[model samples]
Target: MPTTINPLRYPGAKRQLVPYISKLLTNNNLAGSTFIEPYAGSAVVGLELLQKGLIKKLVLVEKDVLIYCFWKCVFYHTEDLCKKIEDTLINVDTWIAMKPLRDIINPNDWDILELGFAGLFFNRTNFSGILRANPIGGIKQASKYKIDCRFNKPILISLIKRLSHLRDKVEINWDDAISFMNKAKKDFIREQCFVYFDPPYFGKGEKLYRHFYLSSDHRVLANFVRQNKHFDWLISYDDDPYICGLYSGIGAKYCPFYLDYTVSSGKRSKGKELLISNLPLPPVDLSMTSSQY
Candidate 1:
């Protein structure tokens, strides 16, 4: 529980793309729109959108109970959580060196600070930060040895900055994304809502965090989006030929981007990953600087 949640450590999070998203928003003059994230894992994009003052209202949904609970604490009991985290961090440097999983996996450690840090720790250190129950399913270790937090003043400050500029208009829900999207699509107007999907990769084998997603579920969602042509959406997925084929007949265009991989135990190993987004595949002829604005 944090008064303010940090944007870091979201598994498969898009915090790094804040600039790109902001640029797109600026270019499109998209403000005051209701930002909807159906599969909001840790809500990096939503949080960043709020921080930048781009969106007026946020509809963020996550299926996980722990993550949902963590956000609940942050929204309702931030001050107390901040105080507890501060008290626990004897020194900034020493605290940063501690692994996030050490507390999350341990049932006995349920302090607000531990919960808050656990969310972050799992995201940055776990395999895809997918939040699977088993630690062995993770792609990497939290750390080989703890780093001293005394010198990690910057880390402390960064977390504090994120905690300060929280949005008041955020709506958090714990529900299956596909079901939520279907209902949300029907209940809300088409033009005002925009969805950003970060579903699990297809054919990636059994996941350490298998509970978070399934290929069959993804198929259902993909079909829903494909059928719901009236809605505006941006779907991101691994660069698969089938994905390209699936959206080929649809109006959705593919844009390729890279996501750095921290976990190497699986097929992806350690390298920048290729992601295909059904969003506007930026004008091929335009320069990065021109399109950036």
Candidate 2:
């Protein structure tokens, strides 16, 4: 299966794990179920499922205001926003102007379309797609880098095409992950819904993201999942001993997944990953290369 390219750059995105996730869903006969993603950073996993017709409905909840606003624009107003992005040129001056806007535009007060435009520009130009903030809560200035592949017109257009089709079938929200999960659990039948969690990994997300999850948060999530044993669910996290110990012997299977990729400087690196699923999963090839999509 071809991987779907994410519309924006995100930290800890699950782009490479989509194929294995799809295989698991297919094996479990839950391909056509309603899918819910609570910690939807880039929403790559949910989008892939929707694109492949594996899920009949997609519910994506993101806590980050910038990401939530960007997805709102993509799903609600694709043409106008994409055209705006297409005509604009990315440079140092544009970046300078957008930095302040990113700091000031509260997702609650500003128009989502405008926020979307700002997010598009900021994400495309930022270093490594890492959304960082200064000590006083202003967006950090992006390092000067050559602009070429990041702002490709063809890729932007393709993203718009994929997102536009989801306007009716998708629901995007800005909410706390735990609260959203609790509410969502009540809305659908346990047998007809599949939840995929890509929460902040232990010891890693705190440094990279502002909305980092702490150890207590992880425990809360585990307790909730344990209590709700009837729901079909899967979670992805970095391979941490603490994380591994939390979900062990909980009627779940821990699968060690791997990804190999070259860094921006062309240095090769590999990482161990984990997928905790309540349903039976097919044997995964831990040696699979990372997706180029």
Q: Which residue pairs show backbone clashes in model 1?
A: 3-78, 92-149, 93-148, 93-149, 93-150, 94-148, 94-149, 94-150
List, residue by residue over 136-234, the lDDT tens digit for candidate 2: 112343333354346666777787766788789899988998898787677766448899988886876776665888998988888888888666999
**lDDT assessment of candidate 2:** 0.74
Q: TM-score of model 1 relative to the true fold? A: 0.70
For model 1, the local distance difference test gives 0.55
- Per-model TM-score on C-alpha atoms: 0.70, 0.87
Clashes of each: 8, 0
RMSD per model, one decimal: 6.8, 3.8
Worst 10 residues of 2 by lDDT: 133-142
- For model 1, the stretches where C-alpha displacement exceeds 4 angstroms are 1-7, 11-13, 27-29, 87-130, 133-143, 147-164, 203-210, 265-279, 283-293
